[model samples]
Target: MGNKKNLFTLAYAKKFLNKKGLELFKKSNQTRSSNSFKSLSYTVLSSLILIIIFFSSPIINNFKNNLITQSIEVTNNSKNKLENVLTGKAIENEQNDKLDILQIFEDIFQYEDKSTSTVRLSASTIEQLFKDTKYNLKDVRKNKL
Candidate 1:
């Protein structure tokens, strides 16, 4: 009776192991396939992102630098033009007055921001004014170059 019980236990153990092994192999195959697909997809996406940035980075940087330079130049030109306008006015007034450009802007524009560069007169209209000023500055200097 003892030998018969041991033989039955061995048969049950063998059947269970075979079934579990097959299930484990199937699960591993599915996981491996999915992971491989995901890895390939990720690699392609990363490569494309890198390529786009590599191609576009220099152009974007150059464009940014050009705009900054142009803006500074425009600000300088505005300063000169504003000064000339005030001085010319003072000369025409013929009151022998020494005009101070900064004071004139301060007295006339009278905004509380207390900044020193060319200013947009009104907050709501600032963008269009800035664009026009920049464009005018560009046009003024275009012939000088």
Candidate 2:
């Protein structure tokens, strides 16, 4: 009786598996093949892009070098023409104009007098000053003040 029951169970299991399990396995295999094909295509695309960039790099570099050389030549020619056009008096006047501009900036930014004193406060003094106020260092830092 046990042998018959076991055989019946085995037969039912085999039938159930044959109906659903085979389809599941076939679908999984198809998905795996599709995933592999996608990966292969991505790899080929990336390799082609890399190959294109590699082949074009020299051309890009040569173009950049030519632009740089042309700019340098242009600047050199401009400098030569400027030097030829400017006499000694004009060069001296240009230098004087540069000095006057520097002087103006210095005059705008310079302190009025060296007699003005800067008071140095210690950390304890700073803390004491803030202790009376509503704002503490932490609050000030948090508020970005």
Candidate 3:
């Protein structure tokens, strides 16, 4: 019984992978390569078709335009909503509340008034700082390029 089983196994192996079966396996491999090439070509062709459809289609252009217009509308809506909230709250409050809200927004947004602070530099102050350097104004005035 064991010998029969072994013989069956050997016969099965020879049917599929022996020298004569090797030629058949090689032919199948060739066909598989050709099949893979065909699939690759189909993939490239489909991708190119999709790209052409995406670019040349008016429906796609309209979709893109709609997306852009919708985004702009959304931004405008948000700005209007913010302004409405600020104005609506300010109208309900006293005059002090309006100043407080403005101050709060200025603090949050860091909108400092630059005109209130002035920096004045004297010529002697600048000359004293550059006394050790050749870039002093007196030296600079005498310098010729």
* Residue-level error in angstroms, candidate 3, position 107: 11
- For model 3, the stretches where C-alpha displacement exceeds 4 angstroms are 1-52, 55-58, 66-110, 113-118, 122-145
Clashes of 1: 0
Candidate order by lDDT, highest to lowest? 2, 1, 3
lDDT of 3 at 52: 90
Q: Quick one: how many clashes does candidate 2 have?
A: 0
Off by over 4 Å in 1: 1-31, 71-145
lDDT of 3 by residue, 1-145 (tens): 8887657565576676765646322445356688899999999999999999877898877888887666533223566667879778432332433456777888867656555577788988777767756475666778743
Query: Residue 136 error for model 1, in Å?
Result: 72
What are the candidates' C-alpha RMSDs?
23.4, 14.1, 17.5
Q: In candidate 2, list every pair of residues with a backbone clash.
A: none
TM-score of each: 0.30, 0.30, 0.25
Best candidate, lDDT: 2
Q: In model 2, how large is the Cα lDDT of residue 69?
A: 62
TM-score of 1: 0.30
